[model samples]
Target chain A: MSSGEIKALVFDVFGTVVDWRTSISRQAAEFGAKHGVTADWDKFADDWRAGYGAGMAKVNSGEDEWKIVDQIHRERLEVILDEYGFPNINDDELTEFNKAWHRLDGWPDATTGLTRLKSKFIISSLSNGNIALLTNMAKYANLPWDAVLSAELAGKYKRHPRAYTKTAELLGLEYDEVMLVAAHNDDLRGAIKAGLKAALVTRPDEFGDAKKPDLEPDPDFNYFAKDFHDLADQLGCD
Target chain B: MSSGEIKALVFDVFGTVVDWRTSISRQAAEFGAKHGVTADWDKFADDWRAGYGAGMAKVNSGEDEWKIVDQIHRERLEVILDEYGFPNINDDELTEFNKAWHRLDGWPDATTGLTRLKSKFIISSLSNGNIALLTNMAKYANLPWDAVLSAELAGKYKRHPRAYTKTAELLGLEYDEVMLVAAHNDDLRGAIKAGLKAALVTRPDEFGDAKKPDLEPDPDFNYFAKDFHDLADQLGCD
Candidate 1:
């Protein structure tokens, strides 16, 4: 569990590093305002995210074919726009709005903490987000990733062993040499099952009352922290 | 043709950025001195690189199964070691020597020029080098790549359309928005055929006296520069 043994730190982006719920809700609220429509922004964010997990799960289970997260978001947006009683939007407008996911605001500790961690380890995103989403998010949020990797590269979703192992293999490191840092216990557990190390980072407000955050860590988890800065401090990163 | 239109610039790494020939030759010369052996180091570098294109082509043509560049390099090293009359080399010893490619020395303009270009556009290595080789080289040579993309991801060799197209697709850029910057005309031509923009950055000393450098650009190339710094200048990178 020593820092010296760890070669890379792969992260789950949506809730771990970026505040997707707040960011998405805020963007949706703004879009709704411009269109003279008022509705529950939090509900919109949650509904959008619900589509993401369901879409990915279907792809993972082979019930649906492979489609990028962008496509999934677009598909759900079309459905939800009708449910919210919004006027019909053009394809161009819908496409630009769909890219709100790319412009997510980072968690308060994200940039500063990641800067500290970058001094010590090769930090990268191991999200289910496609490469384009992760890459664009890195640029938009100024997240200094040494690499932007995704489960799309492995043709599987997170929680799958291939996704975790493929990332380690691409980095040319042993599974134990890479650590998955995330806000979810399930993701950390999956990493551990795949022979990779894990660190639990709690994001208490991630779901905003709609869903419960995994605030506790497994006994076997290497580290647990309130945020990225706390994680940096615990890991001895500058 | 406009700088703003270029979303990503994919680089040819070996000689264009890292001086692999000189780096490998120097490392090999040092290894030779330690072992009390001597030969033309430049020829040694050429011989080592000679196996690379053919090895990748075999995989692309389905004549051989998919293999990473690390394996290709190792296979070449075994043949060259015996030809160069090295004696009593073990598996571990050969592996250590094979990683010389991973420890290449960057050209003087590489780091600064790339930094300048990166400020204006997404810059990544589109070399035939596997992810591990490119990642280790980035750390070793201090190349600031936005991403370390490789032909390894495409499961094909360069000069094949898939290699160039897959890189652009992975970056989520249109083919025309992604530019291939390389010293080799054939590589640029391949990229152009695949609908990507092409920039010819000439490295006159890439082949030394063993072969002629790509001193002339193809008529269809969008930009031509004397070196990486010149390329940056042409691209209007600050």
Candidate 2:
């Protein structure tokens, strides 16, 4: 299938469009310092995010009740804060700190690239994040989204077929007419399995410079680009 | 309640944010000219809209199955086209013409007013218009919406408690924290009945010069203004 057939581009927000690890790490560091604690904040960020997939898996597999990404993050954060040898923090302060995820700065190209992509096709967030989180993040980062769609609406998380398929249906498009754009190979694969086209946009710094990145695309992937700007160009969008 | 307690301002799109009469009449005139027909396009526009509320009522009341606003408009269009003596047109052209609702122009104060309001509160489209219609209209008219929450998502049409309450629920806010900004008194009353604050933003020209407008505000409404700009000023938005 050609890119011309793609009517909408649904994006994965966390590490694909926004540098979550770095953003989370910085905020984690500040919160730690305030509590007179110090630890590998990068590791703290990683540890917090590490539970995301497993948390969603529990819900998708029916082992746990449905909970939004914010709730998932908060549950993991409480455990991590104690692990870091921090003093007890008040619930209000912790709630504010948990919203650090909402304040992430987008990759430099995210805003402009999305603007160009929006000029040609409908662009929206197809994140595991809930609507409130995505809406807050868009304002925080100046992300230009045509609509803020979430797995919360489907009561399931990403990699679950329902999330991707439901988003396409909500946008009034056929599954094949919607393309999932993400930095993760597993996510693209999930979208493909769900009968949606996939584009792998590399974000080498997503996991920080030390770790190897998924720089190469799988054979079945529809498109691979260095970043959102490159993806826009490849898709023939101005 | 004070404006300070209103965390989000949800707009009623059709006659509130957009000048639907003008936009529909303009498009209808062009379609008539193409078909060698002449009629009062304003009356045609009015006739087209007169069915919208009743169409939705049928679904909300379970008298008819669920249908999006676009489908509702198309259903009414068929009846009116016959009355206007429109010659037989192909399905594709009819479908395109039905999208006249999607190409609506925002009121003169819409874009700028919404931008101002966005600085102080979350601004979203809380219309009965389906997600696709609202999304496309936002792009066509340059509406800066943080999210698009529709009655379709709630499986009910406006004036139904589900439509108003569900929108606040989706935005992750309490009913009282979300204010419904609308030109029609009944819609605002529905919102108030659902425990949400109401703002009556009058659009005197919404029905055109011949008819009376909803210029008076209900005594219980939290705020009243002449337009979106006036609403923004009343809300203390920069």
Candidate 3:
């Protein structure tokens, strides 16, 4: 009911806590230059991310076998590399580059804001990203998570109730005791539908200037704020 | 083959990171005084821990349903409490007392040593303890873990190959790239048998004066040290 009842804040990491678009675009541009190629890296970032939803959909629909986000991202990266006019990159180089997702930078307010929230509640990542990606990004970006949880643990991706429910089970908390703090309204709605509380922390720049951000929360959402700092403030976290 | 090859250091928490024996004994003594009951609290702690291995063996052997370590601990606590002649405890009090495991203090070298190790290697809790137990303990004791991994994730307890192999898989690292740093020789041997490198970091007083400690490492272990600090130095962590 109230934000005070929330024992934990499980975050959606990719576009919510970290600016995956900008980070991926920057890395893609550098990779392009190294191969003497040029293209819209922003579009490339979008295209790369486009595969994510579709990839998860296939698994959730039972049309494909269970595969982790890292594998999905790698599969997409291989296809995109060939399309972007790159030479045949060796397996080692591809493997290293595939970890660009692991090197993502958190939004400016992420570290300090999460620290403030951590003082008042157990904070963790509930991203669809695999544990390795979330773990590496936490270290790389200085994101202070008490635990790095993933849909990988549930053997399903988000929007699937199992992912949300399994996380609560793992943390030994009731569904309503955990709140999903995410920038995307869809993710928050998924949490609400799955019996967990929802907080929409807007990142208007999450999709960059081209796409319209979900700036306002739906009426049913428990809390709406501008960013992690705003959410911490609203939750009465010092 | 060497500590140099290790990318991640997964720790065995119970006896290695925390002085659980003393912590549990102190808590038990306090609870007993409140209830007008008395016993050798040290023995109580030992008796409480005694159920852990056998309980896990049942689950690992498919003789019992899978349960987290917290549930396992609670079951043991209930049996011990009755034996200690305690009166009826309300559900809330029993729940609070069961969380004594969560409030454990890190060994003298744990926090500082883990921080130093975290500087160079990805460090995590690879305990048979459940996710909630490990996460709460990390926060309570100021253990700076990059992530928390557990046997609960694999639905098997330590010395089970699945537990060790799944941890490496979750981290996206080769088995040899992740080393198990444990106070127990058998756990280190489990890591080795599962293809991971092993570090025997002794806790000479882990079981207190009544029990023999694992003071020596098997020759096959990749590294050996007296405590976490010594282990950090041997592993070239600053």
Candidate 4:
């Protein structure tokens, strides 16, 4: 694929750009320690993320009213805090603690790789995360994004065609002119179905041994790279 | 007014940071010259911009369906093109020409003042323009926006309470914590009425001799300055 045709690279932030599992687990473990609680933090992270799909599914299916990701996370947190056997926490404390998702750490290659890509293409987070979460994460992790985009803007979640197409439309580009770079084949498939180009960048440690990473791309994916730098190289980005 | 209370400074972009009147007039003049058509370019700019408020008002009032600023501009462009008696232009040419709004020139202090303000606050466009128009304008004019926000995301236009409130909501801020910085009192009044703080920054030459600019702030406004730099100074931005 010619690099000249690409106008923007919309990234799936949770896994592809940041080590969300590790970051969330570490923060959750710290919060647990402060409350004299202990459990498998990785499992905690996974459980928290597990709530994401169901919450978004309800909204996408029109079963639930439209809500921001922060609200969705907070609702899920209320359930998980009870399941994890945490003592009663005040609303203020819970609200602050729930912001752990806003402080995720970028992958080792994320900042540098995105910087390189930004030099050529407009780089943005196209996660299901709300605008505030992605914006705070960009600041916290020093991710240089030309813009911060999210499925929240579309009032839908990823895997929904509107999530992919709305992002392209927002950027004033033809669907194929924007490329979706993600660590998951499902997301790539969604982008492809929405008429956007797709590139898979494998993040082997994304699930922290609790889940299998999609280490290989489908035959139809335009490019696959082990890291952002590798992906930049493959895309011929300067 | 305490500067510390303002977490984000949302701007009215068209005639505030960008010299839209001059920029549009120049481009239109060039296009007219090429097409062998001659008319008052300043009047042309005013006519084009006059359509913007009416277009947005229709959306705000639910009298018309939601449409992006690009579509609004194109709709006006079609009417103005006929008024100027220009030769028939094809869709491709008209589309490219309609993007003139996306190539506005920044006021002399716009970039520097915004850069200073950005060091202290999240500075973003909160215009009736769509994200694509704002993003392209930022890239073209070198405006340093932390985010490109617009009424397009809110599904309403400015002066409507939802437009101001939704921007703050998306930024995860209380309405009072977000300040609207603009060249017009009417826009500032709308923001203040929506519970946001308002800062009026004068753009004396925004309309040249065609119309009088709102060079002074309404007495109820929280802050007033001669230009963006003056606003930055008043806000204590470095």
In order, the first chain's TM-score in every candidate is 0.97, 0.96, 0.97, 0.97
Off by over 4 Å in 3: A1-4, B1-4
* RMSD to the hidden true structure, all candidates: 2.5, 2.2, 1.8, 2.8
Give per-residue CA lDDT, model 4, range A134-209, as digits (tens): 8778878888777789999988899999999999989988899999999999999999999999999998888877
Check candidate 3 and list the clashing pairs.
none
Q: What are the per-residue Cα lDDT tens digits for candidate 2 across A1-238?
A: 2334899999999989899999999999998888889898898999999888889999999999999888899999999888888888888788889999899999999999999999899999999998888999999999999999988888888889899999988887889999999999999999999989999999989888546768899999999999888998998997
DockQ of 1: 0.62
Q: After superposition, how far is residue B2 of candidate 3 from its true place, in Å?
A: 13
lDDT of 2 at A227: 88
- Model 2 lDDT per residue over B1-238, tens place: 2333789999999999999999999999999999999999999999999889889989988999999999999999999999999999989799889999999999999999999999999999999999989998999999999998899889999899999988887887889999999999999999999999999998989998757879899999999998888888888888
Pick by lDDT: 1 or 2, better one? 2
Q: How well is candidate 3 docked (DockQ)?
A: 0.89
Candidate 2: which pairs clash? none
**TM-score, every prediction:** 0.95, 0.95, 0.98, 0.93
Q: After superposition, how far is residue B219 of candidate 3 from its true place, in Å?
A: 0.5
lDDT of 1 by residue, B48-156 (tens): 9999989988998899999999999999998997788877787878888999999998888999999999888888899999988898888788988888789888988
- Give the C-alpha lDDT of model 2: 0.92
Across all models, the iRMS values in order are 1.2, 0.8, 0.5, 1.2
lDDT of 1 by residue, A1-238 (tens): 2233998999999999999999999999999999989999999999988899899899999999999999999999999999998998998799899999999999988999998998888888999998888888887888988777899899999899999999999987889999999999999999999999999999999999998999999999999999999989988986
Where does model 1 exceed 4 Å of error? A1-4, B1-4
DockQ winner among the candidates?
A: 3
